[model samples]
Target: MPPRYSYWTIILNGTATSFRSATRDELIPTLYQLKKLDPKAVLKWFARGRLWESPSEARAAAQQRRSRTRTGAKETSRDRNWRPGGTHRDPKARTAERKKVTRGHRTNSERGRPKGGKVH
Candidate 1:
């Protein structure tokens, strides 16, 4: 028999899997069927002469592109949260607020030293 859809492809575990659907809405059901066959197998979608990470990702991208074209607006740039000169906080204040931990401290030179003198 001839294929129902004009273009559709599904891959699971590096092998092509058979599925029949006449509309894009079949993507979700196809994904679920693949999951049942092999939950841990790698899933992929081949459509529009391009490879996609998953069927859902391709659908989402298509929806997003449609919305953007409908609005006919360019994406706006965002301003940086920082200034060019330097950080807002003062270095001196940060050092003053820092605490020194001296409990159970032993320097490398002080370690393994005898009470008499240095060991030759």
Candidate 2:
């Protein structure tokens, strides 16, 4: 009896198919040959969610996906006014906002004699 572990589930030509391979290493070359023989036979790595022309491409894509996931990127913005590559204080916008805040600025005592008509 053949080992059940030899069976691999794969997507080919947009259809789910299965083939028994002695090892994943062996299956990669077979998929390469199949795609070469038939353009419609788009060999896909369902585990990684991508189509592959060769084993090297599949390996590279998987590595890239792993690198991106490990980069600690935020899935959603949890901050207000958030832009991809900007900080809270933009130079041009920062200077413009500063002028407004300072133009009419007053300190506590400067705000009007401590608010009770008394100057100590």
Candidate 3:
């Protein structure tokens, strides 16, 4: 059978459709089916760069493409807690505070080893 919609039409529709309502995942399977039906259709879409429109769509497509391309079933960590600039506090600050608290117990010689001796 002939294709239901052209590749460009689908890509444009994906971008024009509302982000919340758009069914972006549908594109890959549709493309796959189209590829099976007509290899030329898939090549045509690639030649025109009509696969994905936005960066988000491109990223999603890349991930999907990778998953399909790969053979092994790998486990991926979904932990989102690890991120830069989101540290609870400066660990050095805590360590410095502890050092400062115990610092008074030490003699001047033990603290910095002054060349001229302790500064009484």
Candidate 4:
């Protein structure tokens, strides 16, 4: 069958998933029928392309996004809360944060380490 609506971003059980649906009002029942969510569950949508598992999650996501745009900070505690086995603070990504890890790299001797002491 043809799509009932353009598209919808859905957040359920602390995760974000999307599908085409007729409208927000019709999406819930469709979710229920599809076995994607419980019929009594409620989702909060911050905008057309954003959905959250809860109102608080929605607020937190929005706040994080706003802070990123406002201060241009390189990183934030809120932004790295979700990573595969991490907490459900973010619904979009399930991988490690986008920072480089110095797994086996050697550091210059003059950077801040004692000559013979292990670096933190």
Candidate 5:
């Protein structure tokens, strides 16, 4: 007889359909469910690379999303400038803002650390 489906398995299927992609957390629960259903099936899927997104593709997608979320030019001048109670009071504050915005999301280790630990 076929194994019974668990709640997590059902949730994962639903979420995957809605997102059109599965995050690690989303996949994990499904993996557990699959394991419970059939360990061999889980292993086979992994072997076929049906589990996770390619690292490069995932990174690019995240960057694209971040860029899309930034405030558009339609924002008021006050919104573009620092709020009275906010940080960044300096006239050159935009430089810092640009750096903060463009800075890679990953740390050195993630980007491949330098041999000497000094940033070029």
Candidate 6:
């Protein structure tokens, strides 16, 4: 059986084309071929919470999603030692750290008191 991974559908010259259990890597070349054969061919795939109308769009969204979720290669030593709101802060650097620190219930101290007494 072919890898049951990414699924795609293409409409070209009024003919609908699809494959069974085809992986993303397998379908990418087909997408390029279809595009070359007919520029009007529509490539559709389910990705990023919606149906993407083109392979390029799907690939860009997938790449962005991967970059957000994946870690390490983009990091520098400064990033590892950085803190939120600090002089060396880089928002993307300590995302997980910031999330961890902000998780769970917040206390009055953490929220900071008003200048005067409590509000009515």
* Top candidate by lDDT: 6
Quick one: ranking by TM-score, best first? 2, 1, 6, 4, 3, 5
Q: Cα RMSD (Å) per model?
A: 15.6, 9.1, 14.2, 15.6, 21.5, 14.6
Give the alpha carbon lDDT tens digit for every residue of 30-94 in model 6: 76887897888765665444556655788998798688668645544454756656586665757
Model 4 per-residue lDDT tens digits across residues 1-120: 764322444545656556444356767665666454354444444443555444466667778878887887655454545555546566533333332233444455746677877877
> Which portions of model 1 show Cα errors greater than 4 Å?
4-42, 73-120
lDDT of 3 by residue, 11-89 (tens): 2322432112134365656656655755543222221244444545666776887896585655553355544465745
Q: Write the per-residue lDDT of candidate 5 for residues 1-120, one digit (tens) a residue.
A: 553222122224323322222234565655666657655433111112233335455456657766766745433456455656558476577787788679745666776887567676
lDDT of 6: 0.63
User: Model 1: per-residue lDDT, tens digit, 4-109?
Assistant: 3233455667776665344446666777777897885444556555557666777788899789977976675435543345774455665554532335555546
Candidate 4 matches the true fold with a TM-score of 0.27
Name the regions of candidate 6 deviating beyond 4 angstroms.
1-6, 20-22, 46-120
Better lDDT candidate (3, 4): 4
TM-score of 2: 0.31
TM-score of 3: 0.24
**Candidate 5 C-alpha error for residue 30, in Å:** 1.5
In model 3, state the lDDT of residue 104.
62
Estimate the TM-score of every prediction.
Answer: 0.29, 0.31, 0.24, 0.27, 0.21, 0.28
For model 6, name the residue pairs that clash: none
lDDT (C-alpha) at residue 114 in model 4: 75
Error of 2 at 55 (Å): 3.5
Q: Model 3: which ten-residue window has the lowest total lDDT?
A: 12-21
